[model samples]
Target: MSDEPERQIKALTGALMEVYETLRLICLHLPVPIQLPRGPEYDLNTLVPAVSRLIEIIGDQPMREDEQSLVWGSALNWTAAAKLYSRYLLTGGDFVSRLELELLIQTAGEGLIIYLDGPDSTTQE
Candidate 1:
């Protein structure tokens, strides 16, 4: 792995974590007046920007041969999740859309773990 790929992966991972945390907060703060650690301002403004950075990273980098499948699949999954999340917000948090968004984010997170930890680690688990 070259330094550039490593850099991109690290950046991607950070962006993914941000988006994931934002979504988690959105879900948690929906039904209750709970005080989240990050306060009560986690909304589309925050999510969309983080997601935009994530998409940019995914789009700008070419998938390396070593982890091509995982990267490609993750890219698709993240993009879908972002769109679904937008729909989820627009529809006033539909349960089905939320569920679907969760699934996509979960799958994308797993793919990211595989990419970061090395593909062989998947079999070891």
Candidate 2:
């Protein structure tokens, strides 16, 4: 039981980390700075497309119906990751800090909450 939750958490964390790494790689290839937002006006216009392409590259095989969900889900996960990454960079945290990793994992959990709750549900709001 406890192990089940732990394993699930680990799996989700790994997925988020993978997404983060992929986003980093994609960012490296791009020309923009893609800095973290400073306030509530944080727009995801650039990140959404980059993350969508990354998810497609990473999970587009076999063409399953679930892959569609995965693509969009990864986009959402990357959006959250960008938020935390920006915070880390702005605060002068180390590039690979454990705190940043933990924030990415937590953001992934929030993405899961959004997925499970559906687009219209206000449970997380």
As a whole number from 0 to 100, the lDDT of residue 28 in candidate 1 is 41
- Model 1 whole-model lDDT (C-alpha atoms): 0.55
User: In model 1, which runs have C-alpha deviations exceeding 4 angstroms?
Assistant: 1-66, 122-125
TM per candidate comes to 0.50, 0.32
Residue 112, candidate 2: Cα error in Å is: 15
Clashing pairs in 2: none
- Model 1 clash pairs? none
lDDT of 1 by residue, 11-118 (tens): 444554564554344324322322223524545455555544444443344445545555546656766776666665556555566567767777877776776676
Alpha carbon lDDT of each predicted model? 0.55, 0.49
How far is 14's C-alpha from truth in model 1 (Å)?
A: 12
What does candidate 2's lDDT look like per residue over 3-120, in tens digits?
Answer: 8545544554465555555435433433332322232333445554555565555443444344335334645656666565555445654535545556665665554454445445
By TM-score, how accurate is candidate 1? 0.50
Q: Give me the candidate number with maximum TM-score.
A: 1
Worst 10 residues of 2 by lDDT: 33-42
